[model samples]
Target: MLISDLDCNTLKTHLSGQGLRFRTGPFSVSLRATIPAIARHIAKLYPHSETLDNDAFIDFHITTHQVAGLRRWLKPQVVFSFDGYKPFKPLPLAQAAAAFEWGLNWCIASSSHQYLIIHSAVVEKDGQAVILPGSPGSGKSTLCAALIHRGWRLFSDEMALLSAADGMIHSVPRPVSLKNQSIEIIKAFTQEPVWGERIEGTTKGDIEHMCAPDSSVRQPPTAIHAKYLVFPHYQSGCLTEITPLSKGRASMNLIENAFNFNILGHQGFEMVSDLVDSLECYDFTYPDLKQALDGIEQITSAKP
Candidate 1:
């Protein structure tokens, strides 16, 4: 059953007690939390994600709870735990929900070595996938959020799980994270968006999350080969431009964005080599979201 099927009381009971196990793409996560905001966050963003039974094996077992001692009552803070080991310092209790999202990202990036993971946003269209690898403040997630809402299928907004065995991009579609001004920009772009509460005054400035479309969440976990490797540069008032990039440069960029490149060793090198060899690599610069979307559509639809 989906998380939305459960009432608030029941959902909170599960979260506070034996933990709430849910499926996010290929991974099974069990989250235990007493934070009230967490319930609201999951209920809204993960409404369509399926819940797992208690007996199921979870890939990441996490917990977010208020810190003990006097801090619980004075300036309350929360800590994130992975299988009983606390990896990060406590954050303000108000940021508990965001903490959960960040913590889960760490879990997948740090442990899921079976696939060559890259810090990129991926979207698919007409069976052809576009792999976007950019640094922070590069408008990566903003462009991703726009593409999925336009016509493309949302593969992922945070991580790209590239399979070593099949050389295909696996989908781990989750809520699209919007930070700072991008939050309001997207709210204006989409007609009606399903959004979590706008969290302000955090380390990443103001932050919010937009739910992935129900179709994206419900789609089967199938891997698709990538067709484009576009590194987007969002420059206000600049004319939209797409420049061809050499496969050698694209391979280097992929390695820089990769999470487990060194961990996978030679296998990761082969995967990067294969991807750059096959993908139409480019450097995409845009002034506005409309121009960005149009340029990408034109390039991806062109004959390779």
Candidate 2:
């Protein structure tokens, strides 16, 4: 059954002591935390939807506990449990949740969106969606967080859900993950908008996540025509530059970055290739957020 069809009150009560409720596309996620930090992150990423009134297609039950009994009891279709909060050191709770949600969506994509999900960050402004596909530390999440704060609407910060049938960008707005220095960079850049505690000692080092703007959560998903396929790289003190990339190269790179490309095999390649053909592809590198945002604006504005 879709999450929207479930009883909201029962769900809420079940997750009362948990974290916040984040409703997007077809999911209502209830995290296990009291700080409202994660919830706020969800709000920012999906800033245009109302809280599900006990009915939503997507529901997340997250907890930091180690009890197997609770895990078996909850019986969540997707369960994410970390070891000694180590991996979380470089990825804060909100960011980790975003990654977890993206992975979960991939597990259920066949039933949920019928599309092959990819590991990427997506943002939309002026009716066009910019897809940022990269391996971890490519600075995808950091760039996304900066753009959304500067006025772009977040489609997602970890997963890019692409419609197989038409190559249209699908929205799965969720929290954006920020790791180590990126966390502080974002905080300093955005003036440190009320952040939660930083979880330390993880595979990626110390990490924290920034809440998506409430505006992104509440807004309805927009079917954006793909306009740009940007592979963003963040380098300190490097000048911002956008270089055109061939569709074949972008396709290969994207396939490598995909979580389920091989799982879907030829069908996945075709779907992703079609998406690349439908848009312009580029490799972008930047040392500053302002220049990158301006370059993006130019690209979007130049289109009809």
TM-scores vs. true structure, each candidate: 0.97, 0.73
Residues 62-164, candidate 2, lDDT per residue (tens digit)?
4432224444345422234322221222233334444354444543443434566778899987677899886877888888888888778888787787777
Clashing pairs in 1: none
1-304 in candidate 1: lDDT tens per residue?
9998999999999999999999998999999998999999999999988999978999999999989999988989989999898878999998888899999999998899989999999999888899998789779999999998898889999999998888989999899999998987888898666999888888989899999888788875568989899999999999889999999998998899999999999889998999889989999999888898998898888775
Candidate 2 global TM-score: 0.73
RMSD of each: 1.1, 6.6
Worst 10 residues of 1 by lDDT: 214-223
What lDDT does each candidate get? 0.91, 0.64
Over the full model, what C-alpha lDDT does candidate 1 score relative to the true structure?
0.91
